[model samples]
Target: MEPQSSLPDDLLRAAPKVLLHDHLDGGLRPATIVELAAEIGHPLPETDADALATWFAEAADSGSLERYLETFAHTVGVMQTASAVTRVARECVEDLAADGVVYAEIRYAPELHVESGLELEDVVAAVQQGFEEGMAAAGGRIVVRHLLTAMRQAANAREIADLAIAWRDRGVVGFDIAGPEAGYPPTRFLDAFEYLQRENFHFTIHAGEGFGLPSIWEAVQWCGADRLGHGVRIVDDIKVDEAGVAQLGRLASYVRDKRIPLEMCPSSNIQTGAAPSISEHPIKLLASLRFRVTVNTDNRLMSRTSLSKEFALLSEAFGYGWAEMEWLTVNAMKSAFIPYDERFRLITQTIKPWYAERMSG
Candidate 1:
């Protein structure tokens, strides 16, 4: 196709992609946020869409993780009612499909949307309805699933985990715990993780971004997270000498040997100070070592990125061609929380053929 190493934005945008770490609240369109905020009487620093977009980017550009998280307040503030949540969720799917995402698992905290007297289950139901509407409108062009998340600082893990298991057949595919990862550890919700395991459900934990190897260790070894969210910190355990020789510690070796997928969000990592920059992201080394790395956009609005943007940045930094791009997309497809047969069908029937056609032309 048109010069693999220098593939233009249009080609990258047309490539079928898979995303695993996107947040529903973090990816809202600025206009939608403005409208929703005005309807709910939630005041924003800037009411104009462009100004609000710039505000989110600039506010999240602060190198402090805490500062980066503060940008979500406006997004979450505008999504309290069922209609608003459904609108945001439906728009999220539509946006992803427009960006050529064939399959995605969009995550959100139901607890964060219950301020309007809507029950947590109602929040889940609203988002699920929105997803179905979005999928139907797409005519099966994209498949969307939900990852029910519990705020780490809250005490609702057991409740949200139960909600996920109860609604597994409805739309929920997995469980997660998100929020600050400093004083609040994944161990705080071992019961929820164990419950998910006992019920034969899948889950991923947010670890190794704001914290270090200890957080990753607790999520993997203690709580048995199926995948590590923003797991860029696993690099902490590996030692690279002056001569470029690499030595893997026990924990690093375990993660690598077990083929644990690291849902690495490049721009978000840079904004959160987890990684210095996209060029220096550990995804380069981890992918090179075959550590089951997957690419994602943690927050589209905050980072002003799409899946294509992430691939474009990686292509520029690492000179990745079609083969490497396919490798990353397939890795994410294989690590999806969807059932094996479904995941395989998407890979074989959709992803492979799409990329093969473009790459060979």
Candidate 2:
């Protein structure tokens, strides 16, 4: 018999979720994209909102991370002006809040939004403004923060790292390196990582998704990432025997022993060919092994998913119950880049209480 959760969709939507790996540029509403693109006269593959949504999903499902990223051109293209960027950011928060996300750290590359004469600082400010508006509009239902990202292939990692630190007190909570992981290793940004370390700031690296064990190894061992973005490939180091006994390689063991968080995005991983499907995704095995595993929706528009939807899919694929859902959510809350007291408060006051109620009832 397959294990399953009695939790229904409505209950799952009501469950408080904490997201750590979402991309701001990847979560804009289809209608918003249509209007923004029209204002800038940017050509889209599809004009109709529904058709554009389908196009994004189809384009991202290409199985090559490089090709999947090509879809961002439309999103990044439309988000040139400050107003456009702010609108996208605000809508991102609203959507996540409606999906029952209690806390989120939305990451985006400021460098990508400066095409139309806006400075990098302007981009960050616009996103911050949007986040504030969305939070107030949600009536304190959600708390959102920024994670400024530097493209791994870019040479300005140090600048972006500084930008993250500069806004740390405002709304930005952390920093990250994203983009293709094949040729652009995390070590390339050693200076920025070193700077963050010196400042005692938090950062995550995109690893073990498009690439393999070597990428994850560098992000963890060399770059000292606080968390691994899409670290599904860590399973490469584990050997499972015929009798179901599992052997952990040194790197894998180190990650687990150290309690390094894995920001595993199952649907996004499948679209990028990191894992063949949700059932075969390494998140299941990693979670079972007691690795600090957390679920995320890397891209809401492209993957057509939300935090709740991601958990629902996981529950369906892995036969996870409310207990498992609570575990994954608490793991994300613990792994968040916020301060210990704040994380502890949310885990205790908000997240756990809801789960306790559902489980007990």
Candidate 3:
């Protein structure tokens, strides 16, 4: 166990982690956004890099999903062309790598990036190229897989699923549904999920963030998601007593028993008002209850965080130790959409070895 205030800088740098729920457009570098917007001649809310960063952080703190989502218009406004998509994807990989991420599944809806009249497949291809270039530049083994998201409020979910299946072996590893959570229930995309199921493609659903257990239940029972994105409100399904003990509701019990991974994004949860604050985030509670909780950065730019920053905050708020961090790392790797053999290899060869060396040294 390592104390947060006393955590060695070396340990922070050496921690090997996996990220599974980051959004591609949501994590762009402020400097890159400025440069990209300049190239595209898209007007941004603020031109100054630091000021623009502040704008995103402030706007995302509005505590409403609609406002939080509205911030993406600028990011996507510049990402309509293939070159921008490629560069963003590449820079995203490099940024994650610098934070010691070994693997990441970066997600974005291809439909939104096609405002330039490029087809969906071209969007995927451009991102794939960027990921490859970034991985090569990282000088360490950092693997990135694209999770093709279909905006839940949109009408082209089935088409997106088809595209996901089409690119299954070409760096698109999974499918996802991301958009306003209130009105667009998972049921709206049941056809897409069913199509993905038939194709044997892996997918995750955005649920239980602004909504509650019913959304999570629908994602699991109805949509058949392999993982949950920002499943923070699944906390509503648990009953805690005065003695600090807990009882699991049926859905909670089932999710635990079934080992469905909850992609818990602590900082983003706080910013989005999904959780009251980081100190009260359900991540600690869910981890204590062994609910397959994994740490993530849902939106780096908006939340003003990276994976290391997310871990640092959790460690500070909860007094997390190395074992808890290791558990989270393993949980993320295990819950990754990659094949079982690749996940196991990462656990055995990379995660374990890296942590073991750090502990010993």
Candidate 4:
């Protein structure tokens, strides 16, 4: 941690953040996209930086996941070569460190980056190289890990899962299945999940965002997801009263009982229409109910946000003071895919002391 900053907002920004649900392709620099697209002879709808940024935000605000995902065509288009991948991954870390993310697991589908004839291993290697460079560039102030993702809409999950295991010590921290979750249930990739289970690998599934409680249930019960991605739809299984009492369905009770982490992205949930607004977000209910909830930025480019921005929005909606913020950050670190000792070191050596000072200030 750095020296204590005087500004309240600065303190919030300086606080240690652990992010488990950020997307690599979904958070590219707009200017980098323009340049990379130009070099690759790919045409974007708007080449101008400002217009391109607006295009992503506006396209993603469609209140529909499928429509919102269409905007990724431009981002993924330019990110084919090794150089592009490394640069994007490097800049992602720098940006996250600037936003006060002390640790982050950025997931990306290697298959998506293979359009340029690069093998899956090649893509993973490039990303690992980039993450290492970024970590060193940050002077070891941040730890950037990669989560190799397999698109649920595709059929290469087993391959990616194997790759994740093979590269686990080589910088890949975990595995994930990402894509539209409606028709493509977690059970569709049961073989991969089962393999991961047998191998003692960690994985998270994209569920209960564009889908509902059923998706989350399958991810947890059937696929055995270590964490849930954008699980805002878990609210569907929870009934609340005017008196603030919540009646949890059997599945909800099990999720809470198991202490499963919900990687909730408030802004992206609203953009994807999973939630009506931040103020009305179920995070407040879940947090109050003591669910293992952690805040995150699902996509920085589309949402035009960072970790601090998400914290600020949540603070406004839930009146979260430093204590609440610290608890949520600790929740994320505790739920991280890293080893137990490393996570503890981060919490005790960095997170706890920083928040203690800020809270008592």
Candidate number achieving the greatest TM-score relative to the actual structure: 2
Answer with 1 or 3, whichever has the higher TM-score: 1
**TM-score per candidate:** 0.98, 0.99, 0.97, 0.97
Which residue pairs collide in model 2, if any? Answer: none
Estimate candidate 2's alpha-carbon lDDT, on a 0 to 1 scale: 0.93
Model 1 scores a TM of 0.98
RMSD of 2: 0.9
Pairs in steric clash, model 3: none
lDDT of 3 by residue, 237-314 (tens): 888999998999999999999999999999888878898888889898999999999999999999999888888888
Q: Against the unseen true structure, what C-alpha lDDT does each candidate score?
A: 0.94, 0.93, 0.90, 0.92
Off by over 4 Å in 4: 1-7
CA RMSD (A), model 3:
1.7
Candidate 3, superposed: residue stretches over 4 Å from native: 1-4
For candidate 3, what is the TM-score? 0.97
- Pairs of residues clashing in candidate 4: none
Model 4 C-alpha lDDT per residue in residues 221-278, reported as the tens digit of each score: 9999999997888888899888978999999899999999999999999999999998
State the lDDT at 348 in candidate 2.
Answer: 97
Those runs of model 1 whose alpha carbons end farther than 4 Å from true positions after fitting are 1-5
Give the Å shift of residue 33 in candidate 2.
0.5
**Maximum-lDDT candidate:** 1
